[model samples]
Target chain A: MKLAEAVAALSLEVEDPQILDREVEGGYCSDLLSDVMAKAAGGSIWVTNQVHANVVAVASLIDAAAVIIAGGMQPEEETVKKAQDVGIPLLSTSLSAFDVVGRLYELGLRGTLRDG
Target chain B: MPDVKDVGALMSVTYDVAARDFVRAGEAASKLKRLLQQLGLDPAVIRRAAIAAYEAEMNIVIHSYGGQIKVDITPESIEMICEDSGPGIPDIEKALQEGYSTATEEIREMGFGAGMGLPNIQRSADQFRIESTVGEGTCLQVTILHEAGE
Candidate 1:
């Protein structure tokens, strides 16, 4: 699913200019960095309420396609800019992390067969 | 992929993980992930490598003074050696238990030091080894297999 499409489907208002409509292959929701790093499938869209710069860094490290800041949270300026610099689209929504993740899953965005 | 018997086919990479710097903790793992991608490793192997490297990286940041993770990859498998020179784990058995951690309040606020680092590493690697001294340091060896056709 395209990121724009997902955002629209979720009825989320995209406040950040850095968001682009890249295809989101899958979705993983977690606030624990270790779990995310260990278990997040590649090319998956990440949904979390954590707004720290390290969250951006972890998403990039795990090769997550994009990051959605759930619960209407906006990241710090440095975090947003870093996401832009890394070419990873960042989004925000009022939905809780689980709600967004459930929406993605209900839309048939499930686990992907990650390729090299 | 190159044959393991061919020594020239072996590729090795090392990353230094600093301690107590929560901001820079996951940098080494991120670099390793990028290298794995550039090398065109299998996604499964890449994931395993990421998990191992991440746990090792977290250990350095939360527990030890500092450490280094050295990865040697071949067509057959990837071998990792993580060495730390910080205050070692006094009770390996207790430390191995899930939900057991000695992290400070400051560390917990950052959403880490949950005591899952070692267990995550063990779960991710095909083979695992750990050694530590109470006042000295710690070392871990992890190996993950990439069997034929995997």
Candidate 2:
């Protein structure tokens, strides 16, 4: 699915719309940057509540499709700047991380396994 | 035949990592990633190098007073040297175990300090080495080789 469709389907606020057309292969939810760095697939969407610049770094490193900051968390200015600079779409939702993950799963977004 | 000296060239860059600076922790790794990408390296190799560097960078930020990370990339492989000055790990074996950590509450709140940094670094690198002394500091060296095919 395209990031745009996922955003609309989950009612996520598009903090950066520049990358809405990027392809979303699947989803991986984690707050730990290392886990995301070591496991997230190239085109997967990352669902997490961690709103920091490192999050952007991990997303860019693993080539994650986009980052969805859950629980209505507002990212720091630097975090948003980094995401925009790296051309990764950053989204936010009022729901909790679990809720967001559940909704994305229901929307047919599977988790990209580490080896797969 | 071409000059033997021209067979391989080494490029090195160094960045300073500040302790407890969560905001700037990943800058060094990000720069390294950009450099690797511009060099036309394989994407998987670049990702592995970036992950190892980032993990080392975060360890310095979370545990040490401060440190320096120097990345030396050659035609054959990428090597990262991370040296920090602070209290050192007393037991390397214990520290390498998953889920064993000495991180403070503050660091844990940032979603790091989960006892995965070193393990993740080791997993990401083709070669890894570590040395430390109590009340002094720690040094980590990680290398990721370019695969034979690429």
TM-score of chain B of each: 0.90, 0.91
Cα displacement (Å) at residue B19, model 2:
1.6
Evaluate model 2: give its lDDT. 0.86
Prediction-by-prediction clash tally: 0, 0
Listed in order, each prediction's TM-score against the native is: 0.84, 0.92
State each model's CA lDDT, in order: 0.78, 0.86
The TM-score that candidate 2 achieves is: 0.92
Docking class of 1: acceptable
lDDT per residue (tens digit) for residues B41-113 in model 1: 8777777778788878888877888888888888778889999998898899998897788989877666677
Give the per-residue lDDT digits (tens) of candidate 2, residues A13-109. Answer: 8877666998899999998777888888789999998888888888887888999999989988999988888888889989999999898899899
Q: Please compute DockQ, using alpha carbons, for every candidate against the native two-chain complex.
A: 0.43, 0.61
Q: List the residue pairs that clash in candidate 2.
A: none
lDDT of 2 at B102: 97
Instruction: Estimate how well candidate 2 is docked, as a DockQ score.
Output: 0.61
List candidate 2 stretches off by more than 4 Å. Answer: B1-8, B148-150
